[model samples]
Target chain A: MQILLASSFGAYLFALFRKEFIYAGVLLQLAYLLFRASELGRLPLVGPHDTIVFFTACAAAFSLPFGRLMKGEKAFGNIISVSSALFTALALVYEPRNFPLPPVLKTFWFETHVVLAFMSYALFGVAAVFGYLYLKAPQSLAETLQYKAVLIAYCLFTLSMIFGGIWAYLAWGTYWLWTPKELWTSILWIFYSFYLHARLRQWWAGRPAAVLGIAGFGVVMFTYLGVSLLMKSSHSF
Target chain B: MNPLKKIYQILLSLNTSLWLLLIITALFIAGAFIMPDNPGFGSIDIPLFDWLKRQNLESVWWLWGTIGVLSLLSVNTLFCSIDSIIKKRRVTHWLLLISPQVIHTGFLFMLLAHLLGASGSYHGEAAVAEGSAVKLSGGDILAIKNIEIETDDSGYLSGWGVDIEYNHSGNFTESARISPNSPFIYKDLNIMVKDVQAYPEAALLQVSRDPGAVWALAGSILFTLGILTLIALRMKMEKT
Candidate 1:
């Protein structure tokens, strides 16, 4: 898996059509995820290693559909490849130890919540990249792609939160928790909600909207990783 | 402008909504840092409003401020949504005109759910060994019938379940199994097995009553539907 990821990065460096390499990496990761799930009898999303890999796979898979639109834009491809490689490399730093699924995570809603959440995160990630590319070269296509990506991501993120609420209610008896992670998740959601509304306004239509898109991903990362590392939360990984 | 008309205009403006949302986002960002130091500040075992009242005002001022602003935002959302529909009532694109209002309504429903939950909810937990029973607040009884646990070769718990029998008014009612993710519900009450012990065969069970869960679920469905509908409309507009 490491070698395939490196090859994708190298292909991007060589100015080759890198979509195929990313697709290959995504396939390998998916296969590994399935194999681990079969071995453990549960979804392999418990630890940082598994989740980061899953996140990278989702980002790579979702980025492909925008490949043609991003053609002739070298910086766009470069950003995607470099970030993918950086994230996969970060995943490698974590020990991939197998552990039994905890009682709280033993739910259909939990898995659904995770899958939808990460997929939405991946879409937001792609939108952030488009936002950056738009900054480099102001193009209507880039802006449109960013808006559409955010629109889809917002819907999916809402669904993920819904599933997560149900799961929490079933296990913990409350739909909302006052933990750091939950707070940051709300912040992320509200930030995007702000972005959505900003687009509809005249003053914030272009560059400010693009900047919000970029910063929105920062909120995503902080909500996903920073909160876990910096604060005590029920989220294990 | 008349003072009443100015206040109404402020409540019905999208600008007010945007600014309120931004303020909420900032307050939550502050809260994400503040909450970790004040553990139990967000505990679900107690009613949220009561918990907030018991805390130090210095530490919990952000929370109070958030609640206050959220109330304002809710009013703003309601007013804006109503005003939009009235102004755009003649527009041919009916779905486009109503989608934002639907989203606003969903947001209001969610806020209402939180309000209901914060004001009135019940939570209780008990550890019961096999053959022992715990009396509930409502004079009902819950007895542990059996405990099952499955551990892996490394002694890690792989699976577990607790069988519980419910009695109402000193009369036998029903028997059910409770496990993680599978809570037993009787009326508005929910019973979940939080932990299990092996040698002595004991389990930690939590019973809770949430009056807002249905509202939350309804709000979520509406929120998702509104967003999806808006996205479809926007995409269609872009295509043309």
Candidate 2:
């Protein structure tokens, strides 16, 4: 698994210069996931290591579409490559362990919830990359793509939260919990909602909105990892 | 401008929502940091608002502030949706205009769900072994019939489930099995397996009543539908 992850990271690094390498990175990550899943006899998205790798894979796959949308902007390709490589490297920092799936996570709702949630996180990562591109070049295409990316990401995140709520209600008897992770999730959602509304104002349409887009990825990262690391959360793994 | 009209306009403005959401987000961030030291703020056994009622002002001011801002935001959302519907009643581009209103309606429904939950929800836990009966708060009896624990070949715990019987007033009612995702429900009451222990074959079960579950599901459906519609419309516009 570590070798595959390292190879994927190398492919993404190579993608910084050649766009075709992105596909190689994505394929390697997918292979790693499949191999890990076959070994574990379940989805490998149980801990920080597995989920981060999955998220990186999602980002790399999403970058293909987003890369085309950006009209093959070299900077866009480079940002995605470097970001994905960094995420893969981060995943490699954690020790790989194949723990049996907990009974609470054996539900279909739990699996769907994790998949949707991580997919949104990946999309948000793409949106933030576009936000960075917009800030660098200030093009109408970059700004519009940033908004579109965020819009889709917001919807997916909403659905993920809904599935999570249902799962929690069935498993824990409440739609919402008062844990730090849940609170941070709400914070991330509200922050994006604020960004969506902020885009309507004349003063915030371009640079300010772009900045918020970039800042949102920060919120996502903190919600995904920081909450687990710094606080006592059910999401801690 | 008339004072009432001014207030109405303020409540219907998009800026009001942005500002309120910003405040609420800030308060939530503060609460996240504060929650670690103040664990009671997140007690799962009691309703959150009820727990807040017992907390002093200084300790839980962020929560109080969040509730206040959320209330204002709800009112703003309601007014904005009503105003949009009335103003766009004649527009030909109906889907474009109504998508946001649908989102607003969903938001209102979710708020209502939370309100119902906070004011009326009940939660408690019971530990029981097989063949033992426990009385719930509302007079129903939960009798554990069997405990099933499954393990993998490596001796790692894989899964567990509990079989239970619900009875009322010395009469046999119904029998059901409760697992991780499958909860046994009797009307509004829900019984879920929280934990299972081996050797003695005991389980910990949580009983809860959430009056808002249906409302929340309704709200989630509407919210998801509205967003999907908006995304479709936006994509179409971009294509054209």
Candidate 3:
């Protein structure tokens, strides 16, 4: 399965360079995602390895629409391909196991919380790619794409945090625990909130927004992975 | 200009709100780094304000500073939201004009909920064997009827639940099964099984009461709706 994913990503890269096999590459990636989801018997979002693979699939899927709209379809595909390959390779580090879902995660709220949060992360991942490119090329389309992607991501992040809080209340009898994961997640949210507010100012619209978007992705990665690995908390993956 | 009007203008300034938010964010980051490393520091069982008050002010000045800045930010948020609502009252795109205000209103409600919870919430833990009764706040009693623990093939606990009966003023009341991710709520009180011991067949339960949970939930829902509305309007504008 991993080899198939890696091969599809390679195909995406080839399509990025050639610009002729883009549809075929997209179809291959989508098929791989479908196969993995069917095999898992649930959404491919339960564990870290599953989440990384699922995120890779989402990045490829999202690139199709966002790429066309931004007029940088090939560049977007290249970014998605690189990111998917990197994450899929990272997913291989964790030992594969068929552990049953923990009792605390056997709730609808938990599924909603994790899925929305990860989807937002994938959107922000795309935004960061465009944001970096905008910094390099300084195009209006890339700037607009970065802004819209972050806008959608910010909204989804808000929902994910709310859902997570509700799930915590159900499981632990508290909405907010102020654990390291919770605190850093709040920081990430506030970072993007500041970014959105700053974008409204005439002085901070284009280059500064791009910079912040890229920086916000750094915060997202730290919040998603760093806190779990470094800090002892209930959310440790 | 009148002094009261001057104060209102200052309060309503976007720059002031931005500065306040920045300061609060900084303080939060500082607190995250500077605070003592306790695994259970932020759990519901720990009353944050009460714990802070018990600590020496000189030692935990950052916490007090954070709280003070947050209060000022709340005021700033309220004034700015009201100012925007009044200024945009005549705009044609009412949804776009008011969406941010809806989010602001939600923020204020969540702050209010936190304030109410800080003042009135109660939390405690109790270890109860089967047929043991623990007295809760407001003179209510919780009686443990039975405790069940499901184990996997390796004898590791897969799941656990406690059957509890509530006695209100010596009158028999409702019974509930409290399990992981599922808590039993009686009025504003919530009871959940935290852990289980097999030798004596006892369950460690956590009990808490927060009157502001509903308000916080309502505020979160409103905030989500406001953001969705804003996004929908913006997307439509982009499409057009």
Candidate achieving the largest DockQ = 2
Give me the runs in candidate 3 sitting further than 4 Å from their true place. Answer: A18-47, B1-6, B36-46, B56-61, B152-156
Q: How well is each residue in B100-168 modelled by candidate 2, as lDDT tens digits? A: 888888888998899888888878888899889898865778999999998888897777879999987
- Per-candidate TM equals 0.94, 0.97, 0.91
lDDT per residue, candidate 1, B1-240, as tens digits?
899999999998878878999999988877777777787665557777888888888677888989999999999988878878888899749999888788888888999988888887768888899999999987999999989998878888877888889999787679998877888987657899888888789998888887777788888888888888998998799799
Q: Candidate 1, residue A81: CA error in Å?
A: 1.0
Better of 2 and 3 by lDDT: 2
**TM-scores of chain B, in order:** 0.94, 0.94, 0.92
Candidate 2 runs further than 4 Å off = B169-172
Error of 1 at B121 (Å): 1.4
TM-score of chain A of 3: 0.89
Rank list by TM-score: 2, 1, 3
Error of 3 at A3 (Å): 3.1
The sequence of per-residue lDDT tens digits that candidate 2 reaches over residues A1-237 is: 678889999999999788899999999999999999899888888888999999999988987887887885899889889989998999999977677877788888988899999999999989998899888889988888888889988999999999999999888988888789999999999999999989989988999999999999999999998888888888753
- Local accuracy by lDDT, each model: 0.83, 0.88, 0.77
Error of 2 at A192 (Å): 0.5
Model 3: pairs clashing at backbone N, Cα or C within 3 Å: none
Please provide, for model 3 over A13-114, each residue's C-alpha lDDT reduced to its tens digit, 9 standing for 90 to 100. 676566445455556656765676678555556657767666666666676788778664466667776676677677667644456566787788888888
Task: Write model 1 residue lDDT over A1-237, tens digit each, in one string.
Answer: 445444544543343354456666677677777877888788888878889888988887888888677777767766776787778778878877587777678789999999999999999999999899888888888988999889899899989999999999888777787778888888989999999888989998878888999999999998898888878887865
